[model samples]
Target: MLSTTVYKQLPVVSTTTCYQFVRLSSTLAAPQNTPLSHIPKPSKEDHHQDATFVEPKKSPFDVSTRIYTQQGIDGNDDARYLTKPTYPHPVFPTEECESVTVTHREPRTFGDKLSYNGIHIVRKLFDFVTGYADPSPANPKQYVGTRYEMTEGKWMTRCIFLESVAGVPGSVAGFIRHLHSLRMLKRDRAWIETLHDEAYNERMHLLTFIKIGKPSWFTRSIIYMGQGVFTNVFFFLYLLNPRYCHRFVGYLEEEAVRTYTHLLEELKEPGKLPNFQKMKIPTVAAQYWPELHEESSFRDLILRIRADEAKHREVNHTFANLKQKSDRNPFALKVEGLEEPQPNHGLKVMTPTGWERKDMQL
Candidate 1:
């Protein structure tokens, strides 16, 4: 080894050069969160090239339209239950199913008259049939539907049959004397409108299901029976409320008779008779859900549905008599919030889940 004199040269690096090196390395190793840095350094010509990647567009009406499309979107996607098929023809193939279309009426303003003890369900019926939770009691907006390709006749049928019942004839000023005794008609109207709107959405949903050929027989009967059974029991519970004591029962009876008469009159129309007597309940029930008749038959299910409605009609008549016997005005009693006496029922159906005791807390 030869020891030689070496020139000592201090190597110096420029701050700009060091910074550029660091930035170039960082640019290549892209951080996962920010993609902007991941793009490779491109030539001027490369930047001019057209990019082809695009995202798919989605429809806001997907939820509502899903029912009409055979591909159901009601939480149940099992092919066995909801068979993918084309929409079925209307139950009433001909005649005025297209007549008197339903219009979106102005929403009613809610007030004391539309209170829980007033028009809104007197008491949330906590029965076994409901499966514990009331579907959309707290948030009625969940039931809304997209207004598209709906005919005027179907709209009218839905409005008259379900929406206008309690709000129009039952609670409107000219229709009932005590409806505005407390001057809560406007408020009551609003509440009724909300209920009606919700009902409309529900009906629309069901109709959509029918249109899409998903068989809904079992659920149809269950809903009809459940509604009737619960409503009948609730009628007794309602009788105990002072508001329904005297006039309430009579009003209900009169309404029932009127409805029956109207039904008969409607039957006289050339195309209405068959629809009236042979009303398809399952088709109506499908509006509520997909899995309702997920595993049931239409022929066997319709009988129970018809029977349930009959039972409801009978109970409504009985309640009318009870209200007359009580001799109290519904509006007056409602304003006071004073409950009437409960009926003495010798027969009590013991439930497996047990009844709500006086001190029982939910």
Candidate 2:
């Protein structure tokens, strides 16, 4: 049994050694049978030409390629571009852009004259009120509110008054054009006349109240400043352009005088101002008028009312003639005290009388 076992073990030992020898034989044959180029190749040192890697080509539409920086061109400066378009994206280039000259033409129409004169008067009136005093001695013209209030109210009244009266004469040039669109008075010369009549009515109503001593000091102040400025501007305009200004001032005075006369007739009868006895003087102004202590009478106020209107009427009438004279001369109508008042162009007050025809010596 031992002998048979030993013979079988010999075949097993030989089979294990043969398996190991086959593995060794294959390892030795593997490298020897490979091609030369297939063997491991050595890594060479880097060359400068090899180190450079080509960068990708850039596109024409890149942000840096399309963007540009620009500066502004000033009016006084010479043309930045010699032949650039006059307008941006213009169809054609501009020639003589630097040498081009602009010539101003004089105003030709009546409307233009009216606008210029009206604006000039408005601006001058504004300037006059700049340092003017309110009627009240306590409140000097230091406050801008006083000037603005005076300017606004006077501007409205005078604009209406001038447009209404001046428009009557075709001399005003643009008066017809401006009045053409007003629907209330049929957009005719009548509307301006109505404005004049209304202004006169307002003056009458106010004078009546002042005579009755019913309006407050504050209300009186507003009305007084407004009227005073209106008068000043009216006179100033008359002084500026007499032929046209006379129509407005003369009309205003006539309307105001007529209204005043009518009011006087109405008050002479007993029925007007029913509460004359009951109404009291404003506490402030009554400090000046002692009669308010015993209660006010409407009859007593009438004379004072008429007197004020007459005073303005006289002044306006005198100024109207002055304007007429100035128109003839086309220079300042120098009044005695107001002489040397600087003329704004020819619009200034030069003469003592007013506008006189140039042919007729002032």
Candidate 3:
């Protein structure tokens, strides 16, 4: 048994020594240094280029002259490049400045004046009923009424009411136009279509505000009653004098534009309203106007809505003027120097799963 163990140990030791010897011999045979010809050497063009050779084309600005240092630091050229170009601040118009230049000036027409007066009376009556109290009296800033007074809550409430009323004129006008078309076979199709589209668009605005404001049940009840009364009244008014109806809608939209502009300004001011930053845009608004989806804050959403109101104002005023000029000529109903309203390219009224559809059947 001892002899067999010694023999086994001798074979194991010899096998280990033989493996080590083979590895050592292989390492020694491998070349330590590569051949001079095989070794990579720097090319003449890379290290010894001609001193007088100039680039075929150079940048307009000298690269060496630019000092790329941290921004806003002394001796940093970045400040010069990074600074925004100074622009003259816009001189906005005030109530006192009657002669001030305005982008959308009030229409100079007898019908427009009459309509404006009527709207002013209605507004005064509404204010009385609603108890017109300035919310921000301590920091009073005036635009339409008082800018500082237009808190987020007040603005939202106003939008709720405004949208409810805005739908009235368009719906009334569209229905009247449709009836007239049916009565007279030779109907002005363009005007009818325009009225219907406007009504639908205004209703969309109402829907957007509903989502954002989430008004109280009391407010919703008030809107329902007010809308019912106003719709009938406007329908009769449109039947009596379509021109005047158009003019009235135009003026109403003007007020809307002014009101939204005031609200936008108030929102921009820091620390103006409580929980202002916490306000978010509604999903419905993002769907209707996808252009606002990138920065879908309350401010951006308001701006887009304001633009729609302005467009409506312009269209209604143009329609009023056209009605005055041509009693029944749709061909003559062009807004001078104004392009046709662009279609809502970003409108995706359908839900992702197609489970729901927007009430935009114009």
Candidate 4:
């Protein structure tokens, strides 16, 4: 049994690992056999009556309210402590984030065309269902207040849904490769770790946005269903052709870059997205992106996120070009004193399409 002092020191909402939660649950569980109203009822007097009360949000989607990790937990349990990130996010300089552009790689090979068209189809279907239509760079008038335009809620909905799905590919890919390595009793050439990192980074993006904007229950349900379907589909396809899967994800990242870049352009119009303009970046966001601070606005946060998408685009596209099972992950390890430019985790040197196999030392 834990002492009173130890119980008092426990956090209200822990960002700890799963086994800790399991252990805590076991400690608190009712004894196995004695039942039939054996436990005593609570006294009229309430312990910790002075705890802060948080009103639950009634609206489906509202940016006016922000969700902190322990908002409601403070009333039920008062101890809340911050947790360090499992995977530290890469530092993105302001200039490097700004350098991110919406670029595309032409689909030349048969596999490339198949991946591009398949992704394009899925995107259009999703966009229509979510009521999101990008404001064309050419059509200036369609930026706001139209049937074709996106509102704060719609944009948040898209972001949450997009990220929920985006995280799946990397995890699925990494799992298959990891199993493959174990079965063959050979090294995976350092691909599994990079893929898992991509998944974690995408999840951070989702969590950061959740603090800034609430999604509707319908949207949440959609995310749940979407993730289930996409996970299984990606899992099976990866087993069949990992290269094609990587190529498909590469094209998907191209769309992600385009999506964020469009959002950045909308931020330029004064008074257009007032909520975004006045909003301070969430603590989770600033915590993940160390370069951000109290003064960072939503636009600044988007810039960092866009830069991440740019990197993923580069990484996945490059993965598609390499010999899947044999080639080492070039981005994971770099050669020193090499005269030629190389692929990197950061934006220092990047290619919109991918690094061709011939360009790499392999």
User: Which model scores highest in lDDT?
Assistant: 4
Off by over 4 Å in 4: 1-79
The candidate with the higher TM-score, 1 or 2, is: 2
lDDT of 4 by residue, 1-362 (tens): 56976776565335355568888896788645567447755443332221221224445463322232233222232125547678788788899889888888888889989999999998998888677687656886764666557655567777888888889999999999999999999999989989999999999899877766556677777888888888999999999988889889988988888888877877887876666766677667767788998568889999998888889988999999999979999988888999999987788788978999999878
Worst 10 residues of 3 by lDDT: 348-357
Q: Report, for every candidate in turn, its global Cα lDDT versus the true structure.
A: 0.30, 0.34, 0.56, 0.79
Candidates ranked, most accurate by lDDT first: 4, 3, 2, 1
Q: Give the TM-score of candidate 4.
A: 0.78
Ranking the candidates on TM-score from highest down gives: 4, 3, 2, 1
What would you estimate as the lDDT of candidate 3? 0.56
Winner by TM-score between candidate 3 and candidate 2: 3
Lowest summed lDDT over 10 consecutive residues: which window, candidate 2?
A: 64-73
Clashes counted in candidate 4 amount to 0
Candidate 1 TM-score to native: 0.23
Q: For model 2, how does the per-residue alpha-carbon lDDT over 1-362 read when each residue is reduced to its tens digit?
A: 99999999999999999999998996666445457746744334222112221111134331111100111101112324333222121011122111112111122346335634554564455335332223333543344465433332232232233223322222222243234445334333222332343244333333223222222233335445655665556555533664345334433433434333433444454544233323333222222222332244433333333332333333322334433222221122323554434221111122222222332333
Task: Report the lDDT of model 4 for residue 339.
Answer: 97
lDDT (10s digit) by residue, model 1, range 48-122: 221210111133321111112112222233334653323221232112221212111111223212322332252
Per-candidate TM equals 0.23, 0.26, 0.57, 0.78
> Candidate 2, TM-score vs. the true structure?
0.26
- Cα misplacement distance, residue 110 of candidate 4 (Å): 1.4
